[model samples]
Structures are given as C-alpha cells and as structure tokens.
Target: MSSASLKTIQSHSTRTTPMPRYTMLAVLPCLLFASVVPAQADEHTQPMLKRLAGVWEVEEGMNQGEEIPEKELEGTIMKIEKNMIVTYDREQREVYRALFTLDETKKPVHIDMTTEMKGMPPMKSFGIIKMEEGDEFEICYALPGADRPKEFKSPKGSKVMLFEAERED
Candidate 1:
C-alpha cells in the first residue's frame, strides 16, 4: 500500500476508536451532576423542616365544607419533631402520630404523611404545604381514598381538609 493511503486509513481508524472514550467522558459529568442535584435539594429542604420544629395551634380548619370551631381546635396542639408530627388532644391524650416527607422540587412543595392510629389501619395522605409571610403555615391535604390536591386551596369536597396553623412557640 502507498504511504499516504496507509496514513489515511490509520487516521480514520483512530478517529472512530476514540468515540467511545469521548462519549464516556461526556456522560461521566452528567452522571455525577445528577446524583448531586437530588442530594443538595434534600439538604435544602432539611432546613425547611427544621423551621417547623416547634409548637403550633390551628387558627382555622375546615373538614368537608364544615368549619371547625375554634373551641374545638383550642384543645389541640401540634408538635413537629425531626421526622414526625404528633397531635395532642385537650385531655393531653396522643391523638395522632404521623411520619412525613417533603418534596421541595415541586412548584408549591409537596408533602406525604403516613399516619398510624391506635386502632385504625395505617393511612397515607398527599398534601401541599406552604409557609406564609409570617410564622404561619398552611396545609391542604386529601383524605384517604382521594387523589393528591393540585392547589393549596381546597374546595367544597368531602375528602379534603385544610388547616391554617401558626407557630405558638
């Protein structure tokens, strides 16, 4: 074979062989970046939960289009812990315990709460939570057997509950 022809063939082979390494180099950074993005988002939301670690009282609540009287809620206290929320009744009896997860990547932020009652079966509820201007926060959640709420507002529905709470401590 002529020297020029041999050199041309060698160059063509070299060009095709390096494609795999080039592709691997391109993909490595994306893989690394993908892994870190979720972790950083989780870390950012950790602080948001921390801010909720305190005592709160519900200023307003609606269940199935009926307004819950303030007197009925006055006895209820919501305590938010690291990964759990506990509700106490007027008699200081533990009424509810739920483990919750937050997804801040959503536009309005999404929440999943798994509640385990004393005599009832475990229930999972989907909700959207938002922090207001002050130390108040709101939650509009779908009851069991319902779908996730798209907006923070709950209309006249039988399976939706909305609570407006303020941090007492």
Candidate 2:
C-alpha cells in the first residue's frame, strides 16, 4: 500500500475501534452521581398531596361567592394518585380527572391542575393548597386563563373555586 493509503486505512480503523474502556470510565461517574443525588421534593414530600390521596369529602365549598351545599357534594369522592386527581359523583361516575404538579418550593405550595373531561380540551388551573388546624385541608384554584390565586378566598364573578375537604379515612 502507498504511505498515504496506509495512513488513511489506519485512521478509518481507529474510528471504527470499540471504545470499551473509555465508555466504562465515562459511565461510571454518571452512575455514582445518580446514586448520591437526593430526591427532590415531589408529590412524595408534599404532605397535601400525600394526605389528599385517599377518599375525601367536601366539607365546605364556595364557587364565585355562592356556598355549595354539602348535599351538592354528597357522595362526591376526591381521589389522588401519584400525579393525578380524580373526582367521582354520587353514582361513582367520574366527574372530573386532572393531572397535577406540585411545587413545594413556593410558599403555601403551588399546584397546577389540568382537567380533561370527555369531549373537551384539557383546562388549566393554578392553585395553592395548605393544611388547616386539623385533618381539614383547603384548596383554591383559578379557572383557565386566570392567574394564580393570591389567597384561598375566591373573588365574586371570578372563575375561582375555594373548597375545604376532610380525608374520609
């Protein structure tokens, strides 16, 4: 082979050579780093999310300054999964289902809710949640296109819903 041709072949062979040692060295640090990294606060650390997992009864509810009677919420069940929340009606028919994310980094804890109902596009709602004195917990969320609520109080005429719930444990 010519000198130039030999050099070209050598370069091609090097390029095709397996990088076993280098690959292992590069991946070792990543494995170690992943093992040592602590988990960030997710739904697991968000007490409200954990406490909200089980069945819940709407103790009190207010929508647009109108008080929602308990009977209206009777047999209503709120179920929280890892990253989803579901609500069922008296007949155990699902009324609403939402995927949510929690940011404990925010004071009062920020909650983003996305509800997908049948035949409708998903709706977004910004909310905050906090535990009350006892087993009671309150959540206030703004309707789609509305800004995050500053407080649990829903202003009149605004698409806001403020409600307190008790775990049905």
Candidate 3:
C-alpha cells in the first residue's frame, strides 16, 4: 500500500494524483518527523499544531455549491491535552467549536461541532474527518432538526469548515 492513501494528514492539494493510501502511511513518519516531534523539549509538535491554529479561506469547490463571506477560529491548545482534538472558526460574534480525536486506528479523525447563536439553538454535529490537505478539509454536520447526518463535501462541507494553515503561504 502507498502512504498517500493511508496518511490521514492531508498535504498539498491533490492534482488528480491517484494518491495511494499506503504511500502516505510510508511518507508520514518522515514528514511527521520533520513536523511532529512529541518531546516537550522538541520544538516541533506544538508549533506544527499551532500552525493549524489559524483562520482559513474556503474556496468553494465541486461539492459545495454556495459561498459565504466570513468565518473564524475557536478552540484551545489544551484541546489536544487529552485524547481530544478540539477546534473552531469564528465570524463576528458567532462561534463554532468542533471537538474530536483521531479514531482508534488514528487515520480518519472523528469530529463534532457546536454552533453558537444568540437566540437560536446550538447545532450539534459529527463527522468522519481527515486533515483537509493544504489547509482544507470537509465535514458533514448532524443537524438538530434532522435525523441522519446529511452528506456534505467541499473545501467546507456542511457547516464544518476546518480552518487550517494554508499550505501555499
């Protein structure tokens, strides 16, 4: 198998490349080493995660048929303190926080979100997620008024827009 397919951490925008999963798994350790070192004394892991700590612009793609102007960030570094991986995006006063963690296999990350509004109900949601390579990933939010979670895709799928560090920059 190739590392491309298995590597859950997304990298540059895929160029129609049939990125093999096993390829990514093989490539990850090296890239992870270059990027993720867990030793507190090691200055990489926290910073790399921090690189994930920022705002991102969603370029609506094939799956997402609409566009929105603004979005922001919400979450804590302690989010990763335990086994949970929490995150969010903000727009003006409204905030959306997503809490999740790598699955038992630690490949496709599982995520959940809470949309906060002043006079409306908070939308609680979940998604089977992976890092949107190159600062982009999608999620299918579980709508409060709905039964099954609907399918969503795009740079911002459903209401779950994971703001990541833009790779181009």
Candidate 4:
C-alpha cells in the first residue's frame, strides 16, 4: 500500500463514542492479520494459514509502549475464516472487519491488512507475524500512515501495536 492511502485512512474523524483503548489496540492488528489467510493459499502458506483459522482470545498486548491491562482485554475475541477477520469487544459487539494478505516468504511473515470500521474509511496497514508453539502467535504492526514495524517491540515513540494471542477453539 502507498503512503497516501495510509494517510487517507488516518485522516478520518475519530468516532464520537470511541472504542475502548484496549479493544482497539489489542484486537485490531490480530483482526487485520488473521483476515488475510486466503482459502486458496499456496503450498508454502497453506500450513500456516490452516493453523491460523480459528477463534482466538487476546492474552496480552502493548501499543505505543503502553501495556494493555488484562482487565481491559477480557472478553475480546477474534474470529478468522478464509481471508476474513471479525473482531468483537467485551460486549460481543462487532468492532472491526478486515481482509488480509500474507506473505510467508518473509522471515517473520509479512502481512498487509485492510480494515473497515463502522463509519470510517478503510485503512491499510503492514506488519510482521510469528507463529509460536502450540496454538500461540504474535503480531506487530504499524498504525495507519506509519511505516511497517521491523521488530516485535512497541517501544515509546514507535507507532507500533503488538499483540500475543492464543487459539480458543
């Protein structure tokens, strides 16, 4: 995605009743990354995509160097299926919908997600993903209009969001 597209996504007005901070920070990246697993994934990516297709619960996350308290992440859920990702808040209300593409050829697995939140313009984001042992995985992504993050850290001054999730299904 081009920088201009990212800028357009970031330029939209904020919602009047904003989503909870943790909901937005912790679940958005996962939603975006998970949405990209196409059903027709190539041979090289099929195994990884198969592993990612399921229901997940956010276990922990950090955004722009601030930790997302566990209390805030409670009840957040992400469901992934064949290139589509849907995210729900604690109340079980859908908060985001996105489509994603994955490039497993990259060392850490590159992902590009295009998300459309209610009443907002679609936003495109880039990030890296790592699948860990036994149904655990992590994703680190940049905010709309920011450069893709090179590492998994979301340190101070970085526009990155990092999340670790575990399969719930």
The lDDT for every candidate, in the order shown, is 0.82, 0.83, 0.42, 0.85
In the range 1-169, model 1's lDDT, one tens digit per residue, is 8989976877888646544658999999999988877544443345668777898887888886678889888867789988798988778789888899988888687889999787888899988888876688888889977988887666775688888989888
lDDT of candidate 2 over 90-148, digit per residue (tens): 89999888899988779888899998788989999999988776567788998899899
In model 4, state the lDDT of residue 35.
89
Candidate 2 — which residues are off by over 4 angstroms?
1-47
TM-score of each: 0.69, 0.69, 0.37, 0.71
Instruction: Give candidate 2's whole-model lDDT.
Output: 0.83
Best by lDDT: 4
User: What is the TM-score (0 to 1) of candidate 4?
Assistant: 0.71
**Candidate 4, 87-162: lDDT as tens digits:** 8889999987888888888988888889968788999989998887777889899988999889899998788999
Report the poorest 10 consecutive residues by lDDT, candidate 1: 38-47
Highest TM-score: which candidate? 4
Query: Backbone clash tally for model 2?
Result: 0
- Order of models, best lDDT first: 4, 2, 1, 3
Give every collision pair in model 1: none
Once fitted onto the true fold, the runs of candidate 3 whose alpha carbons sit more than 4 angstroms away are 1-51, 61-107, 145-169
- Per-residue C-alpha lDDT of model 3 across residues 1-169, encoded as one tens digit per residue: 5777645444554555656879989998899797766546633333334433444433332323344333312221212323233333333332334333333243344445455455767666555443454455444434444332334443434433322223223
